[model samples]
Target: MVTDKEGYAQLIQYLTEHLGLFENAGSGVDGSTVMELFEDLLAAQIIVVCGQNPELSFSQRNTIIREVDAIMYDLEEILAGCGRQQVNREQSYFITEFTGLVKNLFDHEIAQLVR
Candidate 1:
């Protein structure tokens, strides 16, 4: 019963696929995009676990926290890495859109958990 919107399935796909980043960066997608995608998926998964089994593994809980922190760190890195005026302008917009998706997904899960 996964929603086809900006929900868990899409977030999981992003983590596995690491979209919005290099397509063929070799091996696997880099950390910034991977972490960003992981964060959203972890958050959604945590909320689900907390609902179904609040006594999730301690390691799993820690993983959720770490993934969320990684997202913030990666966002800062992505913002700072955009060098050159023209590239910086475009990247800044892209970062905003990327972050907005993450924020909306997290907020939606929080709302679902609350209800």
Candidate 2:
């Protein structure tokens, strides 16, 4: 049985290897940016899972949310330096591709804990 951490690692590896698929031409989004966005989005989704899991204490959920907020702040800083139009395009592409990847590769299990 794969632990949650291992499952998350596998998903991250898969996403990293397929980072190009999320890239938008002329969007000014580099591979590193795409990966960061991917990670941030994944972390955001995990907060939802954390909320639903009775196993996690309120403090644990708050901690995870706080960490995710920090990540979002960093991501916001990166986007702030980018062109608004380009960032919007890249963000749209990332959301579409990321959602598709989760549906296809992980059968819509964003956390991949079920696998």
Candidate 3:
């Protein structure tokens, strides 16, 4: 991934801090709910900010997917350690699916940043 570990950490931390992991006390991180929103927003931001780069390649786009995967994996581990029952739900599916979608979109948008 083009982004470094520090960048990934910051992004996950921001998600955890702002969106939070729990809907109520002792409920644990609602992985499905929180991650869906996080992934969507993150993908949208990447498309907006870095989409202007015309030289981006397929491999470069894949790198973004891999990087996001790494970050989310790290977060999932942390949440698991916190005693949260990890769920394979919509958010997880979205993460996997969205990563590929972003890469495909990048192929088109690489020539120019489009909304």
Every model: Cα RMSD to truth: 10.5, 7.6, 8.3
List residue ranges in candidate 1 displaced over 4 A.
1-65, 72-87
For model 2 the TM-score comes to 0.40
Give the Å shift of residue 90 in candidate 2.
5.2
Model 3, which residues run further than 4 Å from truth? 2-4, 10-32, 80-115
List TM-scores for all candidates, in order: 0.36, 0.40, 0.45
Model 2 CA lDDT for position 70:
56
Deviation from truth (RMSD, Å), model 1: 10.5
Best by TM-score: 3
List the lowest-lDDT window of 10 residues for candidate 3.
Answer: 19-28
Per-residue lDDT of candidate 2, residues 1-115 (tens digit): 1113354456456545654544443544544354355465556556556555656656755655564455445444444443133333546576546544432333233234433
> Where does model 2 exceed 4 Å of error?
1-47, 83-90, 96-115
Ranking by lDDT: 3, 2, 1
Alpha carbon deviation, residue 73, candidate 1 (Å): 6.5
Candidates' C-alpha lDDT? 0.46, 0.47, 0.48
lDDT, candidate 2, residue 32?
38
Candidate 3 Cα deviation (angstroms), residue 5: 3.3
- lDDT for residue 22 in candidate 1, whole number 0-100: 32
lDDT of 1 by residue, 8-59 (tens): 4564455335334432233322334433443455466446544654655566
Better of 1 and 2 by TM-score: 2
What's each prediction's clash count?
Answer: 0, 0, 1
